[model samples]
Target chain A: MTVSDPTVGELSEGEILARILARLSPSRALLGPGDDAAVIAAPSGRFVATVDTLVHGPDFRLAWSNGFDLGWKAAAVNLADVAAMGARPTALLVALAMPDATRASFVEHIADGLRAACEALAPGCAVEGGDLTVSDTLVVAVTALGVLDAAAVTRSGARPGDIIAIAGDTGVAARGLDLLFSHFTDASGTPIAISPAALRSLSDEDGTALSRQLRPFPPVALGPAAASAGASAMMDVSDGLVLDASRMAVASTVTLDFDRQCVGDDPLSLSGGEDHALLATFPPSAVLPEGFRAVGAVRDVGAAPVTIDGEPYDGESGWDPYRDWDSARG
Target chain B: MTVSDPTVGELSEGEILARILARLSPSRALLGPGDDAAVIAAPSGRFVATVDTLVHGPDFRLAWSNGFDLGWKAAAVNLADVAAMGARPTALLVALAMPDATRASFVEHIADGLRAACEALAPGCAVEGGDLTVSDTLVVAVTALGVLDAAAVTRSGARPGDIIAIAGDTGVAARGLDLLFSHFTDASGTPIAISPAALRSLSDEDGTALSRQLRPFPPVALGPAAASAGASAMMDVSDGLVLDASRMAVASTVTLDFDRQCVGDDPLSLSGGEDHALLATFPPSAVLPEGFRAVGAVRDVGAAPVTIDGEPYDGESGWDPYRDWDSARG
Candidate 1:
């Protein structure tokens, strides 16, 4: 049957699970799904782990994304956390909760998306195991595990005089989000349906923006590369540059000053969310790694944690999931 | 402020997280929360991992359980899955999603519950890390990691003539659930609020039953012991005995035949669920382990996967979370 043909409620849990399991490729894990627990080789003597949850309403809107996009984004974001730690993602444990009325085909699309993303972004990583439960809305929680190539790069290791650099594009996702909001929504701020033909008519820049917003291409490889290159500190730019920089500064007990020319002219570069870029600091004498571009410099502990162009910029820091969306949007 | 004073909506996410972090004890992990990811020692070469999700509506009810009970139950169930694999749980990662209207204190109580369960049920297991998100309803997802002391035991290894045994009580959780359903609800099955005085008036048996239903204590140590004793196959009795045994039988390609007198007189012993007892099989000549009681024997692959007293016993096998509650209540 096609994905739109049947609803999950119409099938037994076992039937649905069987279909889902059949779609997954064999993982490199010692033991994969279909057992009590999955076993993954951890030759690094330690494992790096992190979890992230995405709910339908606050995290994403169905009008803006499909099951495939949702699954892709989920895997990308979680895998990015592992990359931020300077580790190679090895396995992912997913727990999905959704309403009974959800279409069974949608789940299949999600599984396909997960597979596709893992293959594209983190080649060796696999969707090892997962749990499924019923909820009033769609919720996806992913626990990602990774193996460290070296010592983990932490947020607290940056020192005064360290150089701050970034890998991958910044503000692209935010720009994509703004483009979608402006073109796809009605005057009342509600999304309006767009046909495939209409989408195909979009300008190249607009199309790229929408894709970036929908499926962030996190700099997965740069994390481990940075660590190997002796990065003192690193993190993924999920909550905009200014706020995340401030966080790094606070953790390291230092001040960060961004060079306006180096950061580009885009104001959203400092405030846009979901960039998924690798932000790292290195010793002043250390040569910048490939793919990294200098954006700022670490300074001695100052009254403020962060500044742009030698002055403190007072504005919104980044995305806050718990804040009122309407007011935050304004 | 006390837990009852401020709602989560009244505080920023940062403030709530700060309070939550202060309550957590130091974990055995190499690196704990407050970073991009947690790092845990994995000296065993291979790590066993499993995940489970608990949603408010189907998995639990605020009217029947408090935040502490919710936390305890969540940890108990996930740890049981690790035990089923004949592994010792070492770390837990929790992801909690709730509405903004939830109380800040309630989150603390849940954290306390997680700590208490780890201490009491599986000593040395730590709450390594977790994620918090906003959802329309409350949801808790836990990913448990474990270490193998010996060869991993799986469900597909039971051979003909193997003896089936169980560690821990069989029907206690089901009995507790029945008591709760009867005492906490009216004739129509709607819950009725009871005073603390009324709760205190319950008989010891009823009180014990309710507690078991709310907080199951799985036989954790017995799992590694069973592995060391050369168990051929193993699993946790999360679903009722009949259903879970059938699952084992199917996996092992054998028929499990229970001896009526050996399984006790309680009908619930055969069909009850959520007991979290360790069920394992050993060679016929092998001596039973200290905490285990022999209950059945494995037979050659047959038409049906399970039987009781050499008779085909057909009834409700166990609970299916996705099934309609009222009709499946039978």
Candidate 2:
């Protein structure tokens, strides 16, 4: 007999999953679990992967962040990692924990979010499998898989005199957060509540920004473009552009001097975290490829830290999750 | 300037991950991201995937469930999913959420857990990428990827007259819980301060059980073995053999009669979760696979519920995560 309770569902996640998985076929490369360690075929000999987690209050709010967004972002963040690596995303798996009473709709919405994100970010990257359970608070975690065909770009490949270019905009997510935080009071300061209209507008912006934050729009196609175009070093802009670009420099053991003016003033183009843009360094001899905008150039490594417009900033370096919780509050 | 605190780390999980991903390589199959939708080449044209979530209290204990186990189990559970599909595990990604004060060691331990499980289960499967965040409690979500070489075994292929068999033992984890609850108190309900040595023994058993419970050793190799051996249908015994097997029977439109005598009386053989064993069905004419033993046969679906030796079970059918919780405390 099938027993169903609003509090307790008839099928445990594992049981339901077994039934669902029964429909899929196994691969020769898949080695182990369906029974043990699944043996996967890595003809290229190496596979690409990335992971990300989201917590309640800090990463998302139940009131503002729906389950769909939760699922969407979870997958998005991980897929972006594969994109940064210049790999094609193949499949995705998710792990979720929440309170027992969490509405089934919420869980389904989470799936919907995953579906939506997969539809937009990694088509055919099936939500092949995942785990679900109850927790004190809601948590969503996603891991993404990618495949590299031939040339995989690395941050260390950049050389001096290589031009730095970006595949997409930046900072829109940070701006979206700025708009979001305008509504909520933070530990840094006590702010008054805004009207519903303003809140809604900010939320709408937040949705786009949050979508960027939650389901980052990564330049998955750009990795290969940069590789074929003879780009020296490449990486996705996950952190602030300035901070992430500096990372490329540090990894390559070179100094990267970026022109602040060269980076357009769009907030999304500045400090956003959700815009999965590819920033790469290429030989000056190579013309900046189409769909990529020139940002700056690589230089020799030095004792001094990364500088924008030849000046060091005394303010916040970039977005930090713990230190900058207030920034995401809106 | 960068501000770092033990309680509050320097960068958000996203920022740190972004910086790390910059160093990785990309492939040709990746379509788009850093923009939208990564294009991955599924050479076989199909992907194998699975996800599992771990909560702080229900799934594990912060004190006992060390970081390595947490990480290992997170990946192991999903790997089990792939194994169940008769696929080979390729890559894995993790998403973790925990409190801000969480020691770096704890996170590092979790990574160690992931590494250990991967090594034990699938050597080729590496952690691709994941996200971590601060939360009120710890939550870990992992997604595992697998590649299928041939057709995947599903739960729906069983037919009437097919014998059922299960790999691996069960109930060890459930008995481990019994030991845990009973050790602190005698059977008569008397409080007892157990000696550390006794506690260690219990802990050791718990470790074994928890390993079974947390990181189930799925018999991934058996997926293809069953298929090659002419097994009609197969699935992982996740919730319980009875419940999951019943599901297979119903999906295949058949009634399966299980010989209770065929099921060993070992506590580890009954009502256990996380054995990660593949329970499969084969026609009477088909020889039992090398790793498999016959437990029952499929019959016509009827009004009477699944029976053990032609007798209905008036007692508990099997374990259900939500239903079993009320009695789980014991």
The prediction achieving the highest TM-score against the true structure is 1
What overall lDDT, based on C-alpha atoms, would model 2 receive against the true structure?
A: 0.64
The reply for model 1, stretches above 4 Å from the true place, is A1-4, A324-330, B1-4, B285-287, B324-330
Model 2 / residue B148 / CA error / Å: 3.9
How many angstroms is residue B218 displaced in model 2 relative to the true structure, after the best TM-score fit?
4.2
Top candidate when judged by lDDT against the true structure: 1
- Cα RMSD for candidate 1? 2.4
The lDDT for every candidate, in the order shown, is 0.85, 0.64
Candidate 2 lDDT over A59-124, as tens digits, reads: 776655667667777777677666766677666655666666766556766777776676777665
Q: On residues A1-330, what C-alpha lDDT tens digit does candidate 1 reach at each position?
A: 643557777777777788777766677898888777888888878889999888877777788888888888888999999999999999999898988888888888788777777888899898999998888879999899999969999899999889999998788899988877788887988766656876899898778778878888998988899998889999988888888888899999999888988986576888888878988999988888789999889999888898887788687778766564432242
